[model samples]
Target: LEPLWLVGHTFAENTVGRLMERPPAVFATGASVGSVIEALREIVKQRMVTYVFVIEPAGRLVGVVAFRELVFADPNQTLDQIMLREPFSLRPQQPFVDAMREVVKRHYPVYPVCDDAGHLLGVVKGQTLFEQQAFEISAQAGSMVGVEKEERLATPWSRSFRFRHPWLLINLLTVFLAAAVVGFFESTINQLVVLATFLPVLAGQCGNLGAQSLAVTLRGMTLGELRGMSKLRLVGKEAWLGLLNGLVTGVVAGVGMYFASRGQTVADPVWLGAVTTAAMALCCALSGIAGATIPIVMRRMGADPATASGIFLSTITDISSMGVFLGLAALLLA
Candidate 1:
């Protein structure tokens, strides 16, 4: 703890403590700035404290309320009046990996940890957090790059890369699976080039719909706001949405295609029309499945559904959409 910087409330007052080797100092005034810097000087005189944190009146994270901000605020003002509101905070029970991510994203020297209701718990500085991660914990949490907790004063660039690559690899595998679906339908694609033209449009629309539902669900999950057994109810709602959207999109695309290409001697014009309608419906249905199932499954498996496996979802949508469209095309036009 000697080498580590401990703050009563802010960073500036502690310089004297480093020089004189003394006890830590605390904020004398409730004012946000003058008190914090004054407190910093005291910490330095005492030599035990290198930082100071300013807590708001109600213990909510108003701001880190740094010396810089304090300097700007009125010296006579209380912290409640001068303190910045809605500062980013962390949860005590959060995985260090998650903490690391927030720290890196915010580029903060320290992040405050709090309970669910916004009560202050402790502060984790960027350097110390990195140093505290043991080798085993780091390994079990996967690579320690972006969000993985780094417990050391300085984390190497290469070490950060280790954590990021695994997710990239997972993304690549999901891409390949999607590509495999396209490859499986090479014959159907060859027979009906026109169907291929609309394959993407149908699949893409459904994929988007499903993704919307997934996003709402996941957000609800994260906030602990999705109470009761309403998850299935929510999924059913999206399914109904898919049906409506599918009907509209299919009819519109089918009519547009038929009228736009009326000049061409299109084989099975009626069949083509029917195919478009069916493909849209199927695409929407499958999209809902991919959207709803993936997140639910990820959650059940104790994985972050928000790691955005959109690529995997897209892959599923593409394959399913293509398979349905081409299979129908073959039977109708063969």
Candidate 2:
């Protein structure tokens, strides 16, 4: 029941050993159902008992007997007669995150922790396992935007500043890349001022598309759902999604562009609209690919996938959207 913080352990750094509690109900292989029930009468007084573990003389976990099974079984039956053999277990030294992945689908109220030799060491409450993981998952959004996972609301201003300032500098550098793309198209913007009005629109839409892909990719990775799936396939799927979404949104944006520039005489409004439509679709597709790819690449490099992924994604989407939008305007209209 001790809080992880009190022991200077973060969720990510914890192992099953740190979270394990002494097993509440354990019996040798030959223990009878009546005797186990008798033992549980006193066991329940001190702590909760969900499952009865059957262990060998060497303390190796042999099987598990649920309480319901015990209640219905013949009182003379030995544990070996009713216990489920080769039950799943968690190793004490296994990382909490790994254990979480292993147990996510089991939904057991408690899990037995054992050594490499399968000797029963202790038990970990399912609630404790999930609570730690939930905390880690909750911090992912902050990590995506350059906030350190360790920075809590109670963190001092100075420490928060130190945690956040470096990423802001990196963000500034990326902003300049986007700015340079715009600067590269400076003449195009000057000639067609309407394009300037829609620059934010394109960037905003593509950035949003990229964020969607990023969020899904990170979630899949966290939940271990990405296993057995090809990373290339994931990126391709996101790109396809982006293309479809962009096509739909782009038409609306194109119509808006057509109306916004109707009063202007610099270029044909129809062609301008087409340029917007094309740029939006192309940039969104690219943004989706970038979004999915960035995190995968980061993970391959041994960096946390959620760490500043949003910042990197924003830079990519901004550059692609603006560069494509203005480049298209210049090519087709100018």
Q: By lDDT, who's the top model here?
A: 2
The TM-score measured for candidate 1 stands at 0.54
Query: Residues 99-159, candidate 1, lDDT per residue (tens digit)?
Result: 5545655766556655567655556565655554343243322321124434233767687
What 10-residue stretch in candidate 1 is worst by lDDT?
Answer: 14-23
RMSD of each: 10.9, 4.5
lDDT of each: 0.60, 0.89
Task: For each candidate, give its TM-score against the true structure.
Answer: 0.54, 0.82
Model 2, span 118-165: residue lDDT tens:
877788899999898897899999999889878889999999999999
Say what the RMSD of model 1 is.
10.9
Candidate 1: misplaced stretches above 4 Å? 1-172, 260-267
lDDT of 1: 0.60
